[model samples]
Target: MIPSILPTYNRAPLSFVKGEGVWLQTEDGRRYLDLGAGIAVNALGHANPDLVDALTTQANALWHVSNLYQIPAQQKLADALVERTFADTCFFTNSGTEAMELVVKMARKYWHDQGQPERTRILTFEGAFHGRSSAAIAAVGTEKMTKGFGPLLSGFTQLPWGDHEALREAAAQADVGAILIEPVQGEGGIRPVPDQCLKGLRDLCDDIGALLIFDEVQCGMGRTGKLFAHEWAGVTPDIMMVAKGIGGGFPLGAVLATEAAAACMVAGTHGSTYGGNPLACAVGAKVMEIVASEDFLDGVRARSGRLRQGLEGLVASHPEVFEGVRGTGLMLGLKCKGAPADLVQAGYAEGVLTVPAADNVVRLLPPLNIAEAEIDEALSRLDRVAARVGSDAG
Candidate 1:
């Protein structure tokens, strides 16, 4: 029996001893195809050669250095991020939740610095999963995540997901300082915001002078066949939070913003001790080098089509089990008409791994460099799982 840890996670029974490429191995040596990719963190797959090399090299060198001194690796990673994206400035963090907290603070500070102290209300969409922190829970406001947590943070204003009129009206409020949204809602059920909706929000934010923020923690880092999900909509956010795939599973997150938007965060206004540590930055730099390549992104787009077609075929064969498939690129979700958790368990038993999300959706987050044959193999296992579950339901 496993040791009793905290009751935070309702974990599956299986645990892997090791992993490589798209396969995980149990201690007893049973192999399983990993489609969840550690909930979209392993962009380069488990035990990737480049990532292993970077981590080992950095481990031999310096590990921790306080933020008081200038770190070259941190500066290098920040420069690369700024060059490739709309962000003119970058602030590092240890996790996506921390990055989001910094973004909220930056948003409020922006208005305050501009002499509009009352412009502190931040508008967020319903069904959003910012994080688990107090500020994040307040921004998300989901009953499951916020039920026992008393007295939610004061500055957040929750709006319905994808409601244009409500969002516009909220933006028109003089007290509204910023609008935060996930370009693709991950935990809220892998829903991609319509491009037209994003464009409208950008126009509205511009008109009302409210900063637009995208929580790209789950959908960014080439997971959506692009470096950032907002690129598909052609609308740039004033501030964006990215994590999960940013470090290729090394616990790194960042808040990127245009200089003007981040100008409010002056010295000593906010900071983190291990935010830009050398080891995390070195690994992050290597991850960016590999993921930001044209060939890697092209392969991601090509493989995404393969996975989508296979899922579509699976849905066609087992319509009673699955309602449909949604989402873009590698961050796809299957809408399960039957029990999603049951299907996930069935997949695990069939030597495959999948993740369940809200709205009864099963998420498939394969590695960014997954081969076509691996996609076919995963689909075969999914087909078997679907057939078994469908027969049981019948």
Candidate 2:
């Protein structure tokens, strides 16, 4: 029998009823350390007081005065993003998938307005996940993402990850209008693109007159110890998709673009009814105010270093289970010798939670504001989980 909700996800058996900071309380009252942070959505941790206050305050004042009229909260968030990053304008959305839709449309529309309508193709890389939307699935072009969805949206070319030669060859083509990639692949196993590679992508886009797009939905909002992962490379994308932590668990996403890139979007090119509602933008603004600060980012970097070092030591102590540690800031991943799902299951046994990603990796995306003591506790719990997994394997 089909469940009340769609059974699309292979959900874990655990049922969490409440969350506070980096911990979740199961329905039966068991507490579990949340290292995944709701897949990086709860950047400030579950039920962050500031975010809760912002949402409640905005909810009491106003909730849904759609894009039909001006919204102050939306304007405030847009201003903050513009001041903090490279965007000249921002379009809000309800999720990363909606942001992806705008990114594709904006990139192509720029060329169309410039009298180059044929330059419609956008280049993406393997192991790239933009979103699950038709355009996003088409952009990835992987059999895993596009198998059943046929007659997919055209004009996206998939390239091998880190293949500069192939990237050069593809970008040189006349029809290529843009290049989209995740600065650090979250679902592709928390792989960080080298700084030089990001710089090279920027140079390549400049040379070919193609826009550069970054999908920062998973690695932005200070998850990478920088405001955005691309900032570590000191390069800026012409268009960027941002979400996840930006709302501090509330659903909000945005497509930020340079004025030149967004010139063609005019008034009716794209929009959403529930996108930028007062409740969402209020929470997002608060998240931005906190996460974009130097003090907060410094804390994130410090915690990231400690977590990374601990993960390395953990891997060394349990070589039979773990292979290595990779990723930046709080978005770390543990490469497993066997299926990462097994490690995730072991984490459950140890009253810890992790997210399993591609390439046999168990992701550890704890709250960016996780305290030092919490870090130590998380490491201790992870050590126990590793020991149990290793013993079982032996």
lDDT of each: 0.93, 0.94
Tens-digit lDDT track of model 1 for 1-394:
6667867888899989999999999999999999999999999999999999998898898889889999999999999999999999999999999998899899999998999999999999888899999999988787888899989888888999877788877787889989898999999899999999889889988989999999999999999999999999998999999999999989999999999999889899999999989998998999999899988999999999999999999999998899999999999999999768999999978999999999999999999999999999999999999998999999
Judging by lDDT against the true structure, name the best candidate: 2
True-structure lDDT of candidate 2: 0.94
Residues 159-197, candidate 2, lDDT per residue (tens digit)? 998788988898989999999999999999999999999
Cα RMSD, each candidate? 1.4, 0.7
Candidate 2 weakest lDDT stretch, 10 residues: 161-170
Instruction: Write down the TM-score of every candidate.
Output: 0.98, 0.99
The TM-score obtained by model 1 is 0.98
* Model 1: residues with Cα > 4 Å off, grouped in runs: 1-4
Q: At residue 306, what lDDT does model 2 achieve?
A: 94
Q: Pairing residues by index, what is the TM-score of model 2?
A: 0.99
